[model samples]
Target: MTNKKRLELTWIGKDKRPKLEPRILLEDVARSYHAKHLVTDNDIFDNRLIFGDNLLALKALEQEFSGKVKCVYIDPPFNTQQAFEHYDDGLEHSIWLGLIRDRIDIIRNLISEDGTLFVHIDDNELGYLIVLLDEIFGRQNRITVVSFKQGAATGHKAINPGVVSTSNFIVLYAKNKTLWKPNRVFTARNKRDTRYGQFIDNFDAPYAQWRFITLTQAFARSLNLPIRGLKKAVGDSYEALLSDFVVANAPRVVRLARPDYDAVSGDARSMIDASHKTSEILRLEREEFSDMFFVAGERILFYSDKLKLIDGKYVAGEPLTTIWDDLLSNNIHNEGGIEFPKGKKPEALIKRCFELATIDGDLVLDSFAGSGTTGAVAHKMGRRWIMVELGEHCHTHIIPRLQKVIDGEDKGGVTEATGWKGGGGFRYYRIAPSLLDKDKWGNWVISKEYNAAQLTEALCKLEGFTYAPSDTLYWQQGHSTERDFIYITTQTLGADQLHALSEDVGTERSLLVLCSAFRGNPERFTNLTVKRIPSTVLSKCEWRHDDYSLILQNLPMAQREEETLKKKKSAHPSLFDNQDA
Candidate 1:
């Protein structure tokens, strides 16, 4: 067998991986906002808004949300991308890729088999990000890259000498390409269609007696002007005048399209052939085919069929395309009732993501919450959502904006369009602090911050067990399987205590006992596996380490381990503390 050479994006610290702690969420009751009364029967009250570092947040959600989220969208910081143009081997660029790679790996596991992932990035890191995602989600699972026209160069930007940039990109990928099926969607078009050039003179007449005329002639006749005098009459505004006429008589005007020989459906080809010979308009009578109109071998498309109802007005629309210039970002400053400076994304953009990949009630996740646009849009669209943010704005901005959405008082950005009368709610949670801390002697130990329950749960997560303590059995604090159990405690267990625990475990069952100390003859207890706490967990993770940061606004310095030890030595001159076991 031959080994395959593969291409991948490499950076400093790319090989070193983080063993993220599966930290538990602690909800703040006062911060979690909800509607006073239910306004709709489908009001969702279980959405989550997490305040913490996003990478750790993703790890915490891994166990319960793995392979369950239907859609995942993240918009990470892109300011560091300024390094890409200069081609400097900057540490910030490497750190950006490293942190983003970590989040993407975790997110891939969180998405369902049929789910999709959308990463919003600008052009600077877009190339590198595509390669990274291709490696994680497989090159075959890549769907498309959308070029979003966030704004047009105007105001101060217009004075710039060189070409101005206004486009950002959204890279899309499926968790499993074979199982993923995306919904077809249409977006509002910025311009009207000019293809409906033919107007049926007697549109309501029977098929055999129908008369067709060019739209220019029809427009000229309406004004009692001859066809030759039309161009001189309307002059430069002729196209605009014809467009207005087409909109008014949209159903009567038609565009003639020839059917592709090989690609056209069997029924359509047959219908086109029969119509050409009979010289009559035909309607596809087959129930299996969509209702279609054909005249003399050409498919007839009415201007009315392209109409889309948008913003309380019927306008032209087309299939959603890779270039998304129609989404305007002009007045986004006043939206969401909060000011996030450069971070907040428009809700309509996220709503389109939901329309493409999910339905109402599907679960959506955004690890980089960044002004909480994903959660706010998901809430209004009736999708359950989870958002993670480490910034203080998680309170100052996100919670208040979400409160307005819940109270139905927010009347901006898709709210009026969706008919959202609010009535949904989200729970607020913050990531729990680390479970282990170092002693003054530089020895690893259980943190004093954890209470008994928190300690047991943290240990359960580390040991790969479900934390479900049995009410009847004190020895069963957690379990990996039906008959396999784990028990943790701070007390020392002697030979007699070990024997008692083993007898209770019985011969058919097995138990992992994690205690401060255990004493026994090696071959005595067949049912129990004994180990000491702190020691068993010491090598499993980067214990008590805060060596890195996910934010890449500037070059980061690693937290000095020696400095930490010195500080701890000064704080605790005596090694033994009152809580020591």
Candidate 2:
């Protein structure tokens, strides 16, 4: 045996990856508002609307959401070498690849073992993205590439040198091939097509045909059974066998045989096996065995076991194929009340993704939540969701759109189809300030903007623990495990305080205390461990002053110029610029 060879995509800067900060989310209650029409009986405050660089947002979500999100649908900037009103769509090829690679790495970590990712893209980067996804999600894990018709061919086709683009693609991949289970999607049959019955009908209305065993020589001899409606023919040949049935004009019965079994012994077994094998070979040449059935003086037909009779009609449906053109891709501009004419995806498209990959209450994430389409669709479908965006549209477009969804005032883009008379709400969060910064003496210290609660949560995330404080135990801030707890404080700890903390922890439990300073014996307690803040966490992550627009600004100068032009034309010069300020 030989080792299997693998293929990978390589770019100029493929090896260089960004060192992202593991920041914390801070819910700004003043900016977070809910609709009055929202139902008061349910808990709808858990949905998250994060405003920050998606890379940092994804990193912040790592501790709480790793291997927990059931589905992730991202429509990143397509790098189409054009400027959009809300986003700068042009980028240097290498920079765009690196930016996507970093975010995709984190997305892979965020998805559950059985979860899947649906990445929407156009032809400009589909080939490159496929190789990139194969590297991250593995080649065998790819589910399928679905082609969606965006619109009719444009009139500019005559002037263009290439094919007129009328379709976009959504590529899907599973985190783990063995654990992923995609659900089937059923579409109603067109009334005109139903009348024709060109395909197999389901008792339900639409269905795909499946294979069934038909009469053959192997089936006839294995059970020594005779056809019920037809008399025995003189010869054992297929022509003679069918002649009896053709003359009778009645429903025929035949025995079904197990192809792999042996019933005869010695010479008789060899003779029967050879004869049956030849008959089977001849049967393989017939087309009706796989898909069709022939009836006297009638056209061929096909059906599976699922075929059913309802209301005097046979109804059937086919399995959904990779090519999807039935759903409406346009006319979704009024969805969420955000009229993003340039690149807004239809809610029906995202709805299909959710239907195929997730169930109700499962966590869904969208890093590039342009116009918040993914979030709105996920919300109406009863799934929990988190959306992150760095642009002002996070406020102007997404917030208002989601507000309308909650108030039941939005009546477009799958709202009526899903019967969404809105009820739930979402919490708005900003990425927390950096935890550590250099002081006047060039020594690292905790940022002054952090309050006590913010400090504890940031430290907990840095120390690899969940931030869940105990009500009775003030010192217990978080925990890595049931017995291993972590505590954070700015106060200095002396010998007595150390002894008391150790005693409180007891012999069975242990605590890691993080403070500004400590004065205790070197070998005093086995249940306690002390470490200084700022110094310990400084090395854990790359601390930076700005958390917003870092990923977008890091692109090449040409891309920055395009963004500047986009901002200037929109009369929003400060939109992408000075976001951190």
Residue-level lDDT tens digits of model 1 in 1-581: 99999998888889989988787787899888888999989999999999887777888888879999999998876744333321222336677788788889999999999999999988778898999999999999999999999988988989979989999999999999999898877776656676788888997887557788998789998878899878898789887777778778888888899888688868778888888887778888657644788887888888888877664556677888999887778878878898766677788899898889999899999987877889889998899999988777788888899999999988998898778888979999988788888789987788998989989988888888889999999999999999999999999999998988988999889999999987767357888888898898877876654333443234554345556766887799686355443
Candidate 2: list runs displaced more than 4 Å: 1-5, 35-44, 188-191, 194-318, 545-554, 557-581
Best by TM-score: 1
The CA-based lDDT of model 2 is what?
Answer: 0.75
Residues 41-123, candidate 2: write the lDDT tens digits: 54265799999889899999998899999999999988898778888788767777877889999999999999999999998
Q: Which ten contiguous residues of candidate 2 have the minimum total lDDT?
A: 192-201
- C-alpha TM-score for every candidate: 0.84, 0.74
Residue 150 lDDT in model 2?
80
Quote the positional error of residue 380 for candidate 1 in Å.
Answer: 0.7
